[model samples]
Every structure is written in C-alpha cells, then in structure tokens.
Target: MTKPISGFSKLTKEEKIDWVTANFTQNAAQSKKILQTYWNQNDSVQQLHDEFIENTITNLYVPQGIAPNFLINETLYAIPMAIEESSVIAAASKAAKFWLKRGGFKAKILGTEKVGQVHFIFKGDAKKLESFFTYLKPVLLAESASLTKSMEKRGGGITDIVLKNKTDELANYFQLHATFETKDAMGANFINSCLEQFATTLKKEATRYDAFSRQEKDVEIVMSILSNYVPNCTVRAEVSCPVEDLKLSAELTPQQTAEKIIQAIKIAQIEPYRAVTHNKGIMNGIDAVVLATGNDFRAVEAGVHAYACRNGRYSSLTHAQIENGIFKFWIELPLALGTVGGLTNLHPLVKLNLEMLQRPSAQELMQIVAVAGLAQNFAAVSSLVTTGIQKGHMKMHLLNILNQLGANENEKATLTEYFKTNPVTHHGVEIQLSSIRK
Candidate 1:
C-alpha cells in the first residue's frame, strides 16, 4: 500500500516522480521513463510549463490541428482545433469542405452581454430592503469606477445592475445581478472585479442606510463571482443550400437525403438518450476550438449544457430542417471567449491561432466557434445517416490500438492497408497481430 508523504510538493520533479513510481506503479522504471520522455528538452521552456499550474510533473500533450475552408459571412477562415480524439479534426475538415462546395456557413452575433452576481443574506423587511437598494444602486456603480474605467475606455463596461430577491427559494437570500459588455475579452476578471467591488460597496453602505435597522443593515455577504451561464453572450451559425444540392446518393435522391438528416435531428430533439450523445458530438468540436484558443472550456461546457436544458428538457444544440426546397442546419449557443487576454496573449500557440484567424474580435470568435460545432454535428449526422458512424471512426481509432499493442512502423503500415477493406475491432486486430507474429 502507498503511504502519503509530507512536503511532496517541495520535492524536485525527478524526486517526486521517483517517489510516486516507487510507491504506486507496478512498472516503476518504465513509468519514470515515460514521464521523463515527455518533458521539454529546453530547461527554460520546461520551467515555464511547470509554473502554469501547481505540482506539475511533465506536459500532457494534445494534438493541435487545422480544419480549413470555413466560410462565415463571406469571410474564409481555417479553424484551429486542439484535441486527442482521432476523428474530430477529420470530421470537421470534411464538413467544412462539404459546405464550401455548397454556399458556405453564415453566422451572426446575437448578443455580447455577460453576467455576474453578488449573493448576500438580508434578515430584514422586504420593503425596507427594496428601499435601501434604490439608494444603493448608484453607490454600487460609483464605487466600481476604478475597476470599470479601463474596460469603459475600450467601449466595454458595466451595463446594468439590479436586485433579485430569492427569499422564497431560501430564507434571507438575495442577489445583486450585474451585466457587462466585455468587447474583445472573455471578461471573467473584469466581471469578478466589479462584483467584488459591488460586494464591498453594499456592505459598507448597508451600515449607514436610514431604512435599515441595526440587524437589517448587517448584510451577510455569501460570495461575489462571475456567472458562466452567459445567455446574452450568444451567436448563431447556420448553413443553407437547396435540397437538390445535397446529392449524397444514387439510391436515394437529394430530397430523401435531406429528409433522413432532418429525421435524425428530430429524434435528438425529442429523445433525451440520443440528445445527450448528440450534443456531446457538437461539443467535441466546440471544446476543441475553445481549448486551441486558450479559453475556458469548462465554463463553456457548463453554460452550454445549462442552455440545452433551458427548454425544460435537454435537447439538440444543432437543428436541421427542410423547407421550401432548401435544407438548413444551424446552432446557437453562448460562448464567453477572449482575443487579447488570459492565455490568448501568453500561450505561443494561442497567439499563432489568433493570427491564423486574422485576429478576430470577441464577437467574431463567437461566430467561428458556433460554426465549428455546427460543422462537427453535420459531419457526424451525415455519417450516421449514410455509411454509419463506426466505419470512419474505427478506422481512425485503429492507429491508437496498434500503438497500444506495440506495433512497429512496418507492422502499422501493413495493418493500415489491410484495414482499408477489413473492419477494425479489438479482438480482430488482436487476432491479426498474433497471426503476423506467428
């Protein structure tokens, strides 16, 4: 059994790895070798990566790839995606190419507003609290001037502040709801700074409010933070072409192909089981782009999943329809992205990605992200409706299995050509590998 040690973080990287492998791993030597192999050769670069987060041992790599030929609003772009999933980049690239032959994707910014809140408990009369808030609104805004001034000069700042009484849900619960326009940045820091100031101002002014008694004036601040559920910070991306343009088959006509695709989307909308996986496929694309751009994928995922269930049932994020001889597929969701802050300016690859994208503003990034998700869904569904999903997916996954079983380059090459016509399965590959060894 492994025993915990003190000052584990204080140990040097080699020492920590040595201790871990010795105590925990079955193949201690091999484990240490694998970990050390991934470390950056340059000491300076290795130190930079280690300092990115706490208790870093070595870098974990995900492949960075490009999906080209994405045309949104008459502007063409090649989207950068960072992901370990085998078929994701290929699927996105195929979808972009398919759409390019038809009229390309079109996207529009729906809104740019982000949200934050200050939660507090007020054990006071509701009417008294309301009266005090009226007096407190300007004080909250005025006190946040220093925090919001830089944001304001960039044409982005605090847009609105309102009081929300949630006493019925939980006793003495109240929130100061705030909204902001972050322009070219994700604005988590900006919104959080403003919220902290709101919390401080509310507490300071509550003591002097003429409307509150001593007990009422003592507002217990629970927390002040930015909300990831940015409903107003949204964009819509869609692709539309004549049904006749979807010539996907010789057996079934273009109209039939469109009908089948729409039916697949409809099932996802009404069925929760299918909807969950369906939405995940969409996020496979969204999250990849979000990571590549060095934005917060966790926040984006939380906000998006919340939005999915907003209609009471979690449904599909991408919608498809056949109308007036036209086939259209589209997606609309909130994405809090930044172009000039956070890892966007720090990570070298992120800066290169922004340059590759022509340095779009926040709104433009939203459109690009939404398009990636839509393209991903289109490719997935197109495969599901026609050739079935596993054909391409299993082929892509073959390389991973081969590497896992320790196939050399020559063996991998032979099997790659063999699997072109042969179906790939774990058991089947194992059998083939054994036969080759024999």
Candidate 2:
C-alpha cells in the first residue's frame, strides 16, 4: 500500500514526479522518461506550462487542426480545432465545402446576456423580505460599482438584478438573480466578483433595515457564483438553398436527400438516446473550435445541454426543413465565448488562432461556433441517411488502427490507399498488413 506524502505541492517538480512514479508506477524509470519526453524543448515554454497548474507533471498535447472553407456571414475562414478524436475535423471541413457553393452560412447573434446569482437563507416574513429586497436592490448594485466600472466603460456591465423567492422548493431559500452584458469577454471573473460583493452588501444592509425583525436581519449567505447556464447568450447559424440544389450524394435525389436529413433530425428531436449522441457530434465541431480559441468548453457544454432540455425534454440542437422549394438547416447555440481574456491572451496558440479568425468579436465568434456545430450536424446526418456514419468514421480511424499495430510508414501508406476502396476494420487491416509483410 502507498503511504500519503506530506507537503507534496511544496516539493520541486522533479521531486514530485519522482515521488509519484516511485510510489505508483510499475516502471518508475520508464514513466519518468516518458514524462520528461513530453516536456517542451524550449525552457521558457516548458516553464510557462509548468506554472499553468500546481504539482506540474508534463503537458498533455492534443492535436491542433484546421477545418478550412468555413464561410460564415459571407466571410471565408479556416477555423482551428484542438481535439483528439478522429474524423471531427474532416467531417466539419466536408460540411463547410458542401455549403460553400450554396451561398455559405448565415449567422447572427440573438442575445448576449449572462447570469450570476447570490443565494441566501432568510428565516423571516415573506412580505417583509420582499419589502427589504425592494430597498436592498439599489444597494447591491451601488456597492458593486467599483467592480463594474471598467466593464461599464467598455459598454458591458450589470443589466439588472432581481429578487427571487424559492421558499416553496427549499425552506428559506432566496436569490439575487443578476444579469449582465459582458461584451467581448466571457466575464466569469467579473460577474463572480460583483456577485460576491452583492452577497456582502446584502448581509450588511439586512442588519440595519428597520422593517426587518432580528431574525430577518440575520440573513445567511449560502454562496455567490456565476451561472454557466446562459440561455440568453445565443447565436443562430443557418444554410439554405433551393431543393433542386440540395444534391448531397449521387445515390439519392435532391428531394429524397432533403427529406432523409429532416427525418433524421426529427428522430433526434423525439428520442433522448439519439439526441445525446446527435448533439455530441455537433459538439465535436463546437468544442474543437472552443478549445482552440482558449474558451471554457466545459462551461459551453453545460449551458448548451441545459438549453436543449429547457423545454422539459432533451431534443436536437440542429433543425432541418423543406419550406416550399427551399431546403434549410440551422442551429441556435448558447455559446458564451470570449476573444480578449483568459487563455486568449496567455496561450500562444490561442492568440494565433484568434488572429487567424481575423480577431472576431465575442458575437462574431458565437456565430462562427454555432456555424461549426450546424455544419457538423449536417455532415453527420447526411452520412447517416446515406452511406452510414461508420463508413467514413472507420475510414478516418484506419490510421490510428494502423499505428496501433506498429505498421511501418510504407505499410501505413499502402494500407491507407487500400482501405480507400476496401472496407476498413481492425481484423481486416491486421490480415492485410500481415500478408504484405509476408
């Protein structure tokens, strides 16, 4: 059994790695060597990575790929994606190319409201609490002025604060629900700072209110935090063309292809099991761009799923239809993205990716991200209704399978070309490689 070590964080990086490998790993020397091998060659870059987190081990690298020919809002862009999954970039690029000749994608921001909350417990009269909140609302905003000043100067700040009563759900539960306009930054830190101040102010002012009894005055603050469920911070991306021009494959007529795509989306809409995987396919494109741009993909994921289930049933994020003679497909996503803060300013690759995007504003980035998702869904559903998803996915996964079997470069090249015509499967690839070697 391994014993817990004291002051682990205080140890030097080498000492930490040494202790970790010696205690936990079967082959400490090999583990240490592998860890060191992944470290950046440039001292400065390696040091920067080390400081990104505590008890630093080694950087875990994900491949950064570019999905080109994404035409959003009449502007062509090569969107950068950082993900480990195979076929995501390929699927997104294929979708983008398919839409390029059909006049590209149209995107626009629907809203940009983010939310924060200060939850508290108040064991007092409901009427008195409401009266006190009416008076305390201005104080909450006033006390957080210094924190919001800079954001306000940038034309982004606290929009409104409302008092919500939740006693029916949980005893003595109330919240100060505040909304904000964060402009080009995600503004999580800013919103959280202001919320903390509001919590402080609420507690302080409650003690002085003449209408409140002693028990009411003793308001207990639970927590103050920014919400990741930003339904209002939304963007819409869409592509449409005449039904006759919707020739996705030579196997199906334009009308049949359009109907199949719509039917696939409809299935996702009603079926939760299908919707989860369907949305995941869309997120493959969305998260790749979100990670490459240095935003919080986890937060985006949470908010988007919450939005999907907002109507009480989880459903598809992408919708398709044939309106008259036109075939239309689109997605509206809740994306709270930033172009100016967090990793956007710190990570070298993030900065480069933003520049490659022509330095899009938060709204523009939202539109771009939404388009990526819509494109991905279109590609996935189109493939599903025609050639089947595995046909293309397995083909893209063939290289990983080959490399895993330790095939040489020439073998890999030949096998890749062979799989272009032949079906790609692990067992088949192994047999083919073995025959070639023989």
Instruction: Give per-residue lDDT, candidate 2, residue 417.
Output: 90
Worst 10 residues of 2 by lDDT: 241-250
Give the Cα-based TM-score of candidate 1 against the true structure. 0.97
Q: Whole-model lDDT for model 1 versus the true structure?
A: 0.92
> Which residues of candidate 2, in runs, are more than 4 Å off?
none
Candidate 1's residue-wise lDDT over 291-343, tens digit each? 99999999999999999988999998888888888899999999999998888
Question: How high is the lDDT of residue 240 in model 2?
Answer: 97
Strongest candidate by TM-score: 2
- CA lDDT, every model vs. true structure: 0.92, 0.94
Candidate 1 collision pairs: none
lDDT of 2 by residue, 1-438 (tens): 999899999999999999999999999999999999999999998998898788999999999999999988889999999999999999999999989998999999999999999999999898998888889888888889999999999999999999899999999999999999999999999999999999999999999999888898999999999999999999999999999987768899999999999999999999999999999999999999999999999999999999999999999999988998999999997999999988899888899999999999999999999999999899899999988998999999999999999999999999999999998889999999999999
With a 3 Å backbone cut-off (N, CA, C), the pairs that clash in candidate 2 are: none
